[model samples]
Target: MDKDDQPERTVTKPQARVVDPPPDSEATLIRPPPAPKPPASPAPRKDSGNQLPVGTFLGEFEITELIGEGGFGIVYLARDHSLQRRVALKEYMPSALAARTGPLEVSVKAERYAETFDAGLKSFVNEARLLASFDHPSLVKVYRFWEANGTAYMVMPYYEGVTLKQKLKEMGAPPNEAWLLDLLGPLTEALLVIHADQCYHRDIAPDNVMLLKGTGRPLLLDFGAARRVIGDMTQALTVILKPGYAPVEQYAEVPGMKQGPWTDVYALAAVVYYAIVGKTPPPSVGRLMNDNYEPLSQLAQGRYSPKFTAAIDRALIVKPEERTQSIEELRHDLGLDTMAPAPRPAPAPAPARPAPAATAAAAAPSAPAKKGAMVAVAGLVALVLAGGVGYALLGRDAPAPAPGAAAPAPPAPEPASAAVATAPPPAPVAEPAPPPPPPAAIEARFDPLQDFERVAAGQSADFGVEAATAKPQFRIDRDYLSFTVKSTREGHLYVFLHGSDGVLVQVFPNAASRNNKLRAGQTITLPPPQSSWAMKASGPAGTDHFIAIVSAYPRDFGAIGLKVQDGFGMASAEAVAEAARAQGGAAPLFLGKPVCSGDCVDRYGAALFSSQQIP
Candidate 1:
């Protein structure tokens, strides 16, 4: 095959100090710009590599035009037939790593890019999930997204406007301070919302901001979470940072230099600095190497008020530690503090339980409690006896119980008052009770890891764990492991993965994402899309087990000698096992039964799942 015939290979690095051209249409809708007049005799159009052509249909969406294409995806103006509205549909293409095999099917360019491709794909879905979770006006909203045709697509409202970069060019001058403040207000509020949820945009540049046509409402665009993951996997460092806009910590993930709210503060301030001075403050990395960055206060003197300029400079500080740490602080410095909304309050702690005596006495008379307790005791006793019986059965083929097996008795049935009150004549002959309903399956248990089962000893209706994949099986080194964990009540969640290699790592509630406190009914996705790490399938191919434990209060893993590393707690198997054996106590109880709260050994709930990583 001729070289030109082969799938076009494309890999474009992010440009430093380069202004991205405006898209054919803005990312979202403010009454889309008037469509260009079609030519009288249009020429036939050829496929633009992997891009879907105009008039292509994806489910209910019919592609009307290709509005934009990026290193990672293609943005199209489409008609959502079902919704009867124009929408901006984004398809995860990743030009460098994938190619169009069929009209719609996207396949990896080569085996080399497969892993990176899949990682980016997962991140793309995560990004959609992240966007869907928020409702702030300044943040881009995702109507819906789905995986299809060997890739994925997200539907967003079709928007029409000029990018900030385009707006600056059209005006041929820097925007005024008043205008900048109007833009900053909403954006900062949006930033605060995401920051509160532990997500950072990481990519904030002029072209990524859209100014709606008439209202001039600034809408943030093109979240870089998925792009960052692609960069990390491909070592395409440029894709991870826009030189002049990205802060020093973003240049490299150094120890003691963490990216957080301060990171976004710097980028937003840099945008302001650019708008005022017509230049971004020196690239953060370059500034670090040689301190040549001029403060916006000095650079924009007489052009903007001292307070406004000062706030921008402070946020642009090279060291995050010395910078304006939050949107609130920056807004305050800019003298727009009144415009900022109050922060989302943390989840309230569960109300204090009643005194133990009062609780027990209050709960004692409930027959449901007695029944629940009887069921719990029966389950535990059944589990132990079943295990022994199973062991005995495994050693020999006979269905008959081993000689000592008969010593185990079925759990005594719940007592009835009428039966107890009346004396019964003994039956002449008692038929052997039918084998005790095969020892009812243990309830609300983590069976894969005996350790987890030991830790949370009783049933809990409040905790749930389910795998993301249809089957808990992943192709070694090809698939990513995902699952959702939810606690019906508010609690701290700690999830640990016991890898096929026998390495135990605490995947959630780690150093980077310490906000493991889950709110009631909140479903948390493991390797959260906004999370700094992911759970990719790797070799040593066998079963990998996960244990998700929820506690009424935070449990200190330090006491068990687990230490955080790379956003995960590296735990010694022996230490974890020992802790499980020693600390595995019955779950808390209410109404004479083991419940998720109230009196008992431990106030916790745990669930488990295991996935097979096949070669």
Candidate 2:
């Protein structure tokens, strides 16, 4: 067979030698095969029912599903149509709005209420404005705000991660310093931004802090509760606070006690404590009153270092005067480099005003006249002097004849000669004006809401009512928690405690439905209500938890009857008295027969026994 016609067998091998071009050649050698293209990124998944589509428009964010509900308002997850991004939208709840609005029927009355509501709404606007004002990497960015369907909402960058609360619950606690530092750095940065704006984040609980999924940067949420340094009278009425996180002053009636950096410091320490110990630090106010709190070091089971313990102790001081003076100071104590105090620029000099040129020019003309007058007088004096000299020479021999004529013989010098002898006065020269007095110094004063340090132990303390209408208020001491009942339309206040085991311990009026009214301005200090279960059949040692006090006005008490279940779950009158005696002593009796008969004894016995054994 011919070679050309025969089937050709070709062996394939990796190509090594492509012809190399001369170094100086302009023509390029064959390019290497195009680098393999990277695999395309996966498309983002579209949210289904979970996507919030309400209160939003196409190309605009609309809040759909509510992610959380609280006493003040509700938070929703939203979608930003324009940017195709998810955001968290917090809005006022209708119920909370109604509570704020009150029940005024007249237009004028309603208008007044509406005005107050609008002012309150301004706080939310202020929060958004504050968040908008900052551009820190740690802060959650606020995009926009608007009202729709009589509802106000704010759009913020959506974060897909659990809150510090959930994180604590899931992780049980941070394991190492690195983990805690990583968490706190962003939180502190966010706080620095807040303080820079001269605003206090009245609420700084773990629930208000969010951690981004991939990035660990903490995003602070719910500025709705934040307030400016100036008197926020409205906040007094709202009294937004978390029992565990709020410092002593937060529960104060006076506006000054409600907020400041120390307040924030206390809260931040509480959050850090929770992160480290898996439980909130004891409230400063509660601790001061009860003196029953265990220190964070003890709570941490010796896990926390002395430095960490001291930092938290300083922050959680009961008195604001004893706490860290500023957030920067707190950060410094935490081993972070302190932020440099903002450098103040030197003041600019006062602008110079030119002297009036016209006046100076006019004065210049007058100057030559005075000089010419002097010159003319000088020439005339020279002539007069020569004549006088001639006359004196002629009269010299005659003047010797008489003693009285001797003086005249000397010949008086001419007035012009006197002028010629005097040198012309030098021209006046203007001297530069003394620099204006240094500008007045700017005075700085302590901001009661921002500058106070938490007071240390052994500091003096005082408390008084801030609101006009008398309601129930409480103060704590080492051995007892005292409550003051303010006289209002309502007659009395009741103090109770709900134990950890669901047993209701009535400390005040032992019997249910007892009507007691505390007079207005009257202060009452009662021993901490005694618990009947304290002495009853012992099971295991359990912690005794009780409500400090619950206040009910005359009308509210009458309107809402006491429930048997509320006070130890419906035992018969005899059984209740017997149990009360067994536990401690019998409490003051009141109206309403017990709900259960002999069964009451069994129920009460079972509950108390179970409570003692549970923990």
Candidate 3:
């Protein structure tokens, strides 16, 4: 297909008046209006419609070759003369509205498109400016942008990598959950960041995700903001949205049906669906009608976890309101606590009227609303009641009778084993007891290590730990704790101490010894004699859990946005989770801890040891 005749879209007009390009240090050299081509000149390639020739100069950039073309613009590999580096230069040339009339000049294809083309150009530059403000590894960074030759261009890093689409095609099979989750870690973090600034990708297909060479770190490309602007103006929905990947909201805007983070969530889920099922889900709009979309839970059964599949299903919900509303919600549902510790959990959806069996089941301890320690407490209460224990032994005052209501008589005590068998069937008039309050309503220690352990369960490496203290049970401010960690595979090692004092700190990979690389079968000791730091037992007088992990890949705590305390990176499970959630998009700090795609095995190991802290 010829690039010139390809489908294209236009940008939406900004509410504010369009402004001229800001002054740039590098002056543009304009060429005169185009003249008739010489009869002897060779014809241009069909796909090379109005693109600049190789070696064509635009400001400080020298075009080397055309890299890609879309409805809204053209991308070129260029030499940044000023920086002495290679760059991916993008030109705001909407093919449907504008053309390169002169060697370096872009003009509207027809007089009627003049205003539409100009509006799109402004939006393109603005979008570039917005992208430049973001500093995330997953997002493509725009170094500079300017207007020249009646058009605008933005310079970005010439990243070396293939698209997720291309990579998947070569692999010839769906990626595994860990690999998908690993990919999602950074991508979601990036999306959350942009979405925080009220920017939406709107276009998050596999092709838009570039996996960097060697590292496989993802770089988001071709955001829809500028493309959307032109797309809306041209009323070219088909050209703007990639089918199957796009949600129903993108097909047509309706009351209460609009684009937001969930829109991107749906697209991302669709991408995952493509990776796992070997095809995108049925188009979201079609699902809204006949609703033939099969849940990932059914198709990907045994291949992926229920939590992972359910989250994707929720995000792909046809109605925006019913769908996973934000990436934070999706992350939590997917069990990637990589986001900040305490984002206000998404409100539970209004429950449907349940049948008698479901109502009884809902009141059972296994209910989803009861989490962590709360469930354990509920189980204990049920056991005590079944044992026919005195009310006072239950350790809580019972509520007084309702105002103006008669006090009910106490029921006859029943034996522990016969409690369920002897109880009368629930009456039709009786209401199901309300579920216990969620954990957040009460004082609960937020253990971040639990989240860390959950992620680490997916890793497969042989790790062993041995901890020795200067004293029997480390006395606060008196004794120091030293631990030895050994792994069967050579990899980066990370050690964290979750002190009973309610603080978490990275012990290894600290300022004293930043290099955490450990050789296979090598036994490494923390707080080596050569280091400037020591792991002195701290107080609060409780157990201190020391976690040691040797990962195939080095972890980057920058995504956690933790600050150095003394010489080591200090963080709380609460603080890190909150930061991860806020980061919205960040590369995984420990890729080895998560599940990998295909037959890919992330070789990593972890061991945890506990010691008492005394005053």
- The full ranking of all candidates by lDDT, starting with the best, is 3, 1, 2
Q: Least lDDT summed over 10 consecutive residues: which range in candidate 2?
A: 602-611
TM for every model, in the order presented, reads 0.50, 0.42, 0.49
Candidate 2 lDDT over residue span 251-331, tens digit each: 664654646777788888888877776777665667777756557766665665777677776787777777786788777
**Could you tell me the TM-score of candidate 1?**
0.50
RMSD of each: 23.0, 43.6, 28.3
lDDT tens digits by residue: candidate 3, 1-615: 001221111110000011111222121211221111222123344566877767665533567789888777889987643223456888888888888776667899889988788778778877777876786778877765655567877777677778889988887767677667667877888898999998889899999998875456677888856678777888988778898998888888889988899999999999999988888888887887799999999998997899889999998888899999998998889877654322222221211111111000100010011111111233322111111111111111122211110111111111111001111112112223454532221113123433333233324413322222223255655666565566656777776654322235555564334566778767666655534444454343444445566666554444443344323445443344344333333222322122234664555656544445456
| TM-score of candidate 2 to 2 decimals | 0.42
Q: lDDT of each model, Cα atoms only?
A: 0.55, 0.37, 0.56
Q: Which sections of candidate 3 miss by over 4 Å? A: 1-48, 338-615
**Candidate 2: where is the Cα deviation over 4 Å?**
1-59, 99-115, 226-239, 253-258, 338-615
Note the residue pairs that clash in candidate 1: 28-158, 28-159, 29-158, 29-159
Which is better, 1 or 2, measured by lDDT?
1
**For residues 1-615, what per-residue lDDT tens digits would candidate 1 score against the true structure?**
001122211110000010111221223322222122232122324647777877675544567888988889999998643223467899998998888787677899899988998888888988887887686767887755656567877778677777888777776667677667777877887898898899989899999998765456678999966689999877778888888899999877888689989999999988887877788888888787797999877877897798888888889889989999998899889877764342222221211111111000000000000000111221211101100000000010112111111111111112111101011112212224455321111111112133332333232323332222224455655666666666656666766654322235555554334466677667677656534434445444444455666666555443333443223344433333333333334322110112234553545555544445556
